[model samples]
Target: MSETSSGKPGLTREQLADLSRHFDEDITFSRHIRAKVKEAVPGEATLYIDVQDFHLNGAGTLHGGVYASLIDNTMGLALISEVGVRTATIDLNVRFLGAVREGRVTCRAEVVHRTRRLATLEARVHDDLENLVALGSGTFRIFEKQGRPLV
Candidate 1:
């Protein structure tokens, strides 16, 4: 992955599409997950996710870990869309807003600030009714790897 003159990822729309496909195929953990890039700009992006039984807790409710993972995934994916590089979460802070039961959930994330080495993003998880179920913020360290990139 490369960056554009605008400091955004250099991937074209087609490349982004291909990247999404590859992400789906390569990231087995996210196999049951679906995401859509709602917005993208230099160092910023937003995505959405849906909640299903596979993501539920033992109580049949949306798991807290799942919410955390959703936000983490959203922030990471947003950073990837902007930086054109793989990133790892160095720190994460999540707050439960409300109980998440069944149905779909939408997660939105955006890069709030960034430097050469690190980027910060904020994400929110909402239930199908559009109620905020959780909120999170995270920092990721950008890096280049020898193998395939996941985000």
Candidate 2:
């Protein structure tokens, strides 16, 4: 197998497409939040969600949990895109910096470091007006399932 920049097996474009499709179709919570894959490339992933009434908290702004979820999911995407391996978030940290009541919100994540069984990533969420809404970082445990496809 060809190696990626991270020295892991590289995935082809088709594999990446399938992975994104699986996330969009099979992940119920991501779809429930209206998150769509905007871009996915080795070491990076971008997702966007259109703000709706249901995504708001009691303060009429986007909920903190929503930001945390997006951060965790997007970082996972970044790691998988690079390594083409399965991973689970072991730790996630999010800091809400601003608020958004409506319009689109985008999250972009990038893999900052990686090892044989772990990856570290950072994500930022921005509102439609280009305001920084949240910042996050997470660590994921990488492992392969016995019979699952790597991608």
lDDT of each: 0.72, 0.85
What TM-score does prediction 1 earn?
0.79
Ten-residue region with minimum lDDT total, candidate 2: 142-151
Candidate 2 ranges beyond 4 A from true positions:
1-9, 145-151
Model 2 TM-score, all chains together: 0.91
Residues 114-139 of candidate 1: C-alpha lDDT, one tens digit per residue: 88879899988888788988999999
Give the clashing residue pairs of candidate 2, or none: none
Candidate 1 residue spans exceeding 4 A from truth: 1-10, 32-49, 144-151
lDDT of model 2, residue 36: 86
Tell me model 1's lDDT, rounded to 2 decimals.
0.72
